[model samples]
Target: MPKIGLIGFGKAGKAVANVILQHPDFTLDFVVRKGLKQEYYSVRDFIGVETDDPALIYSIEHIDIETFLDDHPVDFIIDFSSQESIFYYGESAARRHIKLISAISHYDEKTIEFLKHLSQKTVMFWSPNITLGVNFLILAGRILKKIAPWADVEIVEEHFKLKKGVSGTALKIAEILHLEDEQINSIRVGGIVGRHEVIFGFPYQTVRLIHESVSREAFGNGVLFVASHLTDKETGYYSFEDLLGPYFQEKENDGLC
Candidate 1:
């Protein structure tokens, strides 16, 4: 089992943590959260699950980054903690030659550049929206556009009421599909985790590609996919698309089977 460390303990983080805990392929070593009050509680106890796993919870408020990484080594570190956490642990992770998988959701170009530079030291993938179904939707949407270049398309995203503004995923899709901001629609209702749809309006037919994230566990599936594919990969700064794109290959033939 690959030893892993998690960088956040919020709603999304906990959901991913639960996925990791329930699985048998990965051994979750530690989770680091800012302002966390507990230091030695296993996720099993913390989440009240019946398991003997040794996943501990750590707080940045109490532990030094370098010493913590040294004391508790891991094969890979998954960051769902914060947008700025990479700056704190990037060098340490690189020095230890640990793979990095981040789902920070948002980052400035400077932070992205930092990840690129650190990639020289070890394997790293910075997935902004690390959901398997959503990424597949992105790839499928591209194929649909290529197949029907004349079709008109619009992007629509919906989230919970507390989420403000258009989602990053919607913006990314719009950019990939070459659509304007006005062509993208945003809707916020009660506690919808996330939903993104691409509606292709052809002259005679309509095509819709949708990915709905009912729970954050969808992210764990993404993590499992990335980890399985990336374990033996050479060091580089890869986007989520980089991992999934190659698998979307086309088989050439003149006739259908």
Candidate 2:
């Protein structure tokens, strides 16, 4: 079983932990978060685990992530944490020769450059959205862009009210379509998991591509899929799209209608 360290304790992190515990191929070694109050429930409860083995349910405060890693090395580090967390521990993970998979978004140019630099030392895969369907939408957007270069393109994204900022998937689609000048409509409404739509408008026709994330578990499954595939990959920078080649090829071979 591959040992894994999970960073962050948000919805995505909890979902990933839930999935990891059920899978026999992976072991959840440690969870890193900001702080743990004494009155709070144990790490097992935080991660929604029923049974408790102290070793299996260990939680490391963010400040001690490096120390925990030094004593209990992990083969893969999955980060659903903030950009600051990525920047802080990325180089450390690289130096330790640990593979890091990040699903964080809203990166400035400087942070991206830094991540690219870290990739040279250790295996790193970064994606704004880890969901496979979102990546397929990206691929579809790229295809549509080629077929309709003259069409005006726009993206609109919707998420739960608690979600802050625009959808990184929408931003990424805009980038892929070279529609940098295009505006993205980001809606924060009630109970929405996620939804993104890309529209191509020409003089007389319109093309639309859409993806809806029904639940956070989709992202957890996607992360698990990515982690499983990284066991044999060489050290390098990888995008979510880079990991979709096989899936796309298989679809093509099946003769998509």
Candidate 3:
């Protein structure tokens, strides 16, 4: 079983942790949360244990990643933390030779460049959204763009009110279709998990490709899938698309259209 360290305790992180706990091939080794102590009795309790079994004690520790690398041996680290957290821990993780899978989104250009630099030293995977459906949409958008090079393309993404700016998934699809930032629209509303639509306008017809995330578990499941494949990968930068590309190719061979 691969030992894992998780960063952040937000909705996505918590959801991924739950799925990890249920799986047999992975072990939840450590967690990095803001202001966590050095040691803990139970991982569940530290992260708000919700199980019915009161006596289930799994000795997992929590620490800020600054101190985490000094004394721990973790096979992989999955970060759903803030961009600031990634900036803080990126070098340390590289120094410790830890593979990282980051799901944080909307980083500035400088941070993105820094992560790319860090990737040269450590195995790193970063994606705005990890859901397989969204990546498939990206693939679809690319194919559509190739088929209709003259079509005007635009992206509209909707998220919960707390989300800021356009989604990374939207930006990625735009990049695929060579669409500018002005061509993308962002809507923030109530409690939406996530939704992205790519519209292509031709002379007299329009086509739309959409992907909607119904639950955070979709992301968790995607993370689990990516983690399993990324563990022994060579030191380099990667995205969810890189991990799933072969599967998509297989589907294409089997008639994806």
Q: Each prediction's TM-score against the native?
A: 0.93, 0.87, 0.84
**Residues 57-147 of candidate 3: C-alpha lDDT, one tens digit per residue:** 2212433455756766777888887888787678988888788888886678898898888899898888888887888888878878888
Clashing residue pairs in candidate 1 (N, C-alpha, C atoms within 3 angstroms): none
Candidate 2 lDDT? 0.79
Which is the leading candidate under lDDT? Answer: 1
Ranking by TM-score: 1, 2, 3
- For TM-score, candidate 2 versus 3, the one ahead is 2
Root-mean-square deviation of each candidate, in angstroms? 2.1, 3.0, 4.1
Cα lDDT of model 1 by residue, 164-237, tens digit: 76788888888888889999999999999999999999888899999999999989878878888889999988
Candidate 2, backbone clash total = 0
Between 1 and 2, whose lDDT is larger? 1
lDDT of each: 0.87, 0.79, 0.77
Q: Which stretches of candidate 1 lie over 4 Å from their true place?
A: 251-257
Error of 2 at 53 (Å): 7.8
lDDT of 2 by residue, 1-257 (tens): 78888888777877777877767677777777765642234556655675432323344443555676798788899888788888767877899989989998678888888889988998899899988888888897887788778888888899999888777778888787777734688889999988998888888888888989898888888888899888899989988777876565646556853
Flag clash pairs in model 2. Answer: none
